[model samples]
Target chain A: DQQVKQNSPSLSVQEGRISILNCDYTNSMFDYFLWYKKYPAEGPTFLISISSIKDKNEDGRFTVFLNKSAKHLSLHIVPSQPGDSAVYFCAALGGSQGNLIFGKGTKLSVKP
Target chain B: DAGVTQSPTHLIKTRGQQVTLRCSPKSGHDTVSWYQQALGQGPQFIFQYYEEEERQRGNFPDRFSGHQFPNYSSELNVNALLLGDSALYLCASSYRTGNYGYTFGSGTRLTVV
Candidate 1:
């Protein structure tokens, strides 16, 4: 069973627009959420993360919002640039030691 | 500092063959985790090693085993490989404590035929 899900497989947006990626989870024990970006042939790079205690966290142009009641979370990039085009995977930490469970991932293409 | 480094960028193996993949963690990091990523899918955790012991393991089978050396480097070994085992193997390194985010290696792409 897929504990975390990212329904959108691909998304395209123009430069300077907002790029949003959504993820949902079925497990209630997940308390920490993280986003990772990956390029072709490279391992995923850590992006932003949010703890369950907070509803929102922002870093520069990237922001993450979590809605506990809905069992959903989203990553938003404002004024998205072409360089931001990559596959984004949403991950959650479950259990006490923070073992991570990842979603399928969404490929984002930001066109100039 | 050097980030996580994995060797044998690509490999090809026949069914039932055995293969070993290597990894060296980043500087000052002592924990290593292994993950397998199938095409167009997110990574699946295999197991994690800390202090040369298997600390946590996912739903993988016994055919997949690993060893962490005293130097904090690691090796992942797959025996009796099946075609379904073909995927990108990734190694991530993190510290034992603190909020240190994992640093991943480029990965070793294994193709089992």
Candidate 2:
């Protein structure tokens, strides 16, 4: 069974959109969550992360919200630009976690 | 400082052939991890090396093996490659103990026929 799941395979948004990507996880032991972005033929680059202690974390135009009771997390990118078009992956881990558990990813397309 | 560096940007091999991929970790990084990503799929952890030892592993088979040198550089080797082995191999570097920040390389594309 997949510990992390990104149900949406793709999402489209207009430039300057408030794009929101959602993720759900089955493992309750996950104490940390991170988002990574990847372009074609490239490795994933870290974007933002949130500890279980906090329900929300914001960084500039990006914000991440975690709902512990729902086992859901969402990444919001305000004023999305064309450069934001890429694959977004959700990763989760727990304390003493050896490796991260990653979802299938959601491909975001921001049009001009 | 250089992030992570992977060699042989792309390579092709046939079934039963073997392949070796190399990686140089970022400065001040002591741990190395390898991931495999198939098309339309997220990267999956293969294994990790720290202090020149295999510290953790994923659900991959024995065909996936790796080595971390004293300098913190690493190499991933695959023997008896199959067509299913074709994918993008990514190398990530992190600190041996502590924070979870990781730096990833561009990755090497391996195609097995």
**Candidate with the greatest lDDT versus the true structure:** 1
Candidate 2 residue pairs that clash: none
DockQ of 1: 0.64
TM-score of chain B of each: 0.96, 0.97
Model 2 CA lDDT for position B107: 98
lDDT of 1 by residue, A27-59 (tens): 888889999999998999999999999999999
Q: What lDDT is reached at residue B47 by model 1?
A: 88
Writing each residue's lDDT as its tens digit, candidate 2 over B13-111 gives 999999999999999999998999888888888888989998888889998899999999999999999999999999999987335888889999999
Clashing pairs in 1: none
Tens-digit lDDT string for candidate 2 (A36-97): 99998778999999999999999999999999999999999999999999999998863363
TM-score of the A chain in candidate 2: the value is 0.96
Per-residue lDDT of B1-113 in model 1, one digit per residue for the tens?
79999999999999999999999999999999899999988999898888899888899999999999999999999999999999999999988822348888999999999
Give chain A TM for each model in order: 0.97, 0.96
Please give the distance, in angstroms, between residue B34's alpha carbon in candidate 1 and its true position after superposition. 0.2
